[model samples]
Target: MSDAVKRLAIRDRIAVLDVLRGLAILLILLMNIPAMGNLESARIDVTGWTAADQMATWLQRVIFAGTQRGMLELLFGAGMLIMASRAMQPDGPVAVADAYYRRNLWLVVFGLAHALLFMWWGEILFPYGLAALLIFQFRTLAPRTLMGIGLVVLLASGHWFGTQQYNARQQLLHDAPAALAIKAEGNPLSDDQSATVKRWEDLQASTKGTGKETQEERTGRTTTLAAFFKWNAKFWMGFTSDLLVLIIFEASATMLIGAALFKWGIIQGKRSARFYLALMLCAYAVAIPMRVIDTQQYMTLALDPRPGWITYQISRLAMTLGHLALVNLAISTGVGRWLLKPFEAAGRLPLSVYFGQSIICLWILFPPYGFGLWGKFGMAGMTAIAVGVIAFQVIVANLWLRWFENGPFEWLWKSLAYAKLQPFRKTPSAIHITAPI
Candidate 1:
């Protein structure tokens, strides 16, 4: 086959992979909705929430927290290996290296559009693309090596994050009382004291957001397109930095594990049913309890770091793998395959589905540009609407895929990567998971 053909002609589809990707789409919404709708500072510190919001927050933390992003990172790793494989290249006009880099660069561009244009400051594609570029060199390593390095990075990053949290807690504990004392004495607070008070108040507000904070945020988001863009752009700066520092490291580690998993045949459904079952059970056994405890600590301990923060990386990795194993186990079972069938549409068009979700929620549902329903829903209500949106996307994705070869964004990505307009309508020969989502 020509290099160009190899760049675009991989047609084999892994049912288990599709189902797992589809599951990721479903899982991401459990968290993304509230992040888009609520006050930006209230992501974790829901201090004075109603019982339902608190329960919803804890339940989601236990079930979904890091696993959704984990799945996406790992899948991107799998996709990276698939694209970077030397088997896809030979002496020809098009090179796998060029295609791989081009595809990911365009992904970065798309991510920029998603964040800057569509107003989702927390989008993943930017970091995912950047991480892919950094790690592409490591794809050819042995699976064991990849996994070992990934685990090491994961541990180091987790420790660093935990240490930062611990230090912040210590600072707040020391400074908050001093700042309060100055205020009580009616003395002019020093500059540092004033800054300390601001930090302490922000922390407190994260738990129980003030009306002014929430209202100001809502007004900024819903006042006009310019205002909305400015709000998201400003947030994009800070959020994207955090992603680059900590989240990207975590994502890179997960993707490395993903590359290892793909090579080990675990992600490919080449393992036996018994193997998947044992893996699923073993992984969940290790992760679920830690995650539950972690959530409880974050909820109960004010301004204190979660007990599981240090080892939380292990729990997230284990839980994500457990979810992957469960999906594979389901694929091995006849009934399980049927249940996952609905998700194939989302899996098939991950780029479009992912972007479409932002357009629906950020563009239409919550912003002044659409329903103007920002901050109207709590965690539970936002998630409830997320359920409806997910269902709608699945149905629409299925319908679109029936007559089209690629989702619109997928087609654009491939065309740009290949530097040519590729075929788009459905045909016997079309692309599949030869590349990642």
Candidate 2:
């Protein structure tokens, strides 16, 4: 390896990266709490909402919705590049490549377990692992080149996907009444028409419920382990089938952008304060307005929601970048150190924190066997739960790291990646001391 690679390998961990991860994890829980707890009414639909619930919904839409996940994806991409840089040491490329794939392979395994056992439909790990496998090939590209390619792919995919969804929604609405009329007349519909009608029905059923009972009640009634598996397996199969393209596109594109940012040193707090300030200003100036308009159009106008979807790509990307810039600025300006420790600890042990969250939610929120809290919480309640979960994780992470070198899951993952057992305990001798002389 060249001196550049060696220098990269020996560079200290960037605190801001961990802070970003910690913030992302916290925000992600907030964004996902409603879905995890099966709070269907807490979604964008504002039907029969209380003032507090409406406020919560608006806050989620304006700030926490897609942005957290976007930041997480960006960080994942940056982490990939950082790992790859270390792996490119002299005589280590092949070994590093092996470990990279191994790590991601295990991530896929963990993600599968998370989805099936935890009953969480919003599992991102599997999609992230799959995207990583494909993204690894571009690790050596220049920052500008990677960013260019990522932007093009992101825009293209967003436009194509949004147009398809728009057309589908329009077609579904157009066909529903006609199909119902045919059914009322006792006439056999054509197979194609029937298929469209079925799609419409499925959408309605999934989104609006069947009216027999809430989906949470039906799904949460599973008492046995076997029943839970059976239900989740079916759910996973359907969820992945419908959203696979969107998942892959979103993960891959944002990751590529992250990789580019890592190379540029922007994500490492190496950029000037003025540069970050400008980035923050410009990105938010564009993104916040677009987001507001998009939310308003969707909530009030009952529009097709496709234009918003397409613009979402632009707004989310800009806002995510802006968030990165703001974080960098904070760190560089010295405001980050005191406030960042808990987040850094949580971020360092992200895998543990992530799985820990699933466990907690399962025990507290999953039905019959647990608290049966699914669908019981409104937006405000869910937000409170999310805050509580984050606070608990932060405290636990700080305490755990005081004695351990890695989170339990992180140790296991690293051991598997390196094909050897890793030292989990923090050794006193490993701590540096000044010479008595």
**Top candidate when judged by TM-score against the true structure:** 1
Which regions of candidate 2 fall more than 4 Å away from where they truly are? 1-11, 39-48, 86-92, 182-188, 201-207, 211-217, 220-223, 301-303, 429-437
Q: Which consecutive 10 residues in model 1 have the weakest lDDT in total?
A: 86-95
Please give the CA lDDT of all the candidate structures.
Answer: 0.79, 0.74
Estimate, for each residue in 1-437, the C-alpha lDDT of model 1 and write its tens digit.
34533543435666567768877976698778887776775535342367777888888888788888899888888887776665323432346667777788998999899899888888888888888887777877889999999999988989888877777778888888988998889999988889888888777766666635555566678689888887788778977776576877888888998999999988868899999999999999999999988888877746765658678888988998898888888877778877878898788789888888899888888888799878778777777898899999889988987778878988898888778886679776553433321
Q: Residue 267 in model 1: shift from native, Å?
A: 1.3
- What lDDT is reached at residue 88 by model 2? 45
- Score candidate 2 by lDDT: 0.74
lDDT of 2 by residue, 1-437 (tens): 23323212112666678888988886688877776665342224322356776678777777666888899889988988777775544445575677678889888887887888776667888888898888888887888988998899888888888788777788778878888789779999999778977766666554555532245335544456566567667767788998977888888988999999888878777779899999999989988888887766655534254476767788888888888888777766545656665688787788898888878886566565778666566677778888999999999998987788778888887777667776688787433121110
Q: What's model 1's overall lDDT?
A: 0.79
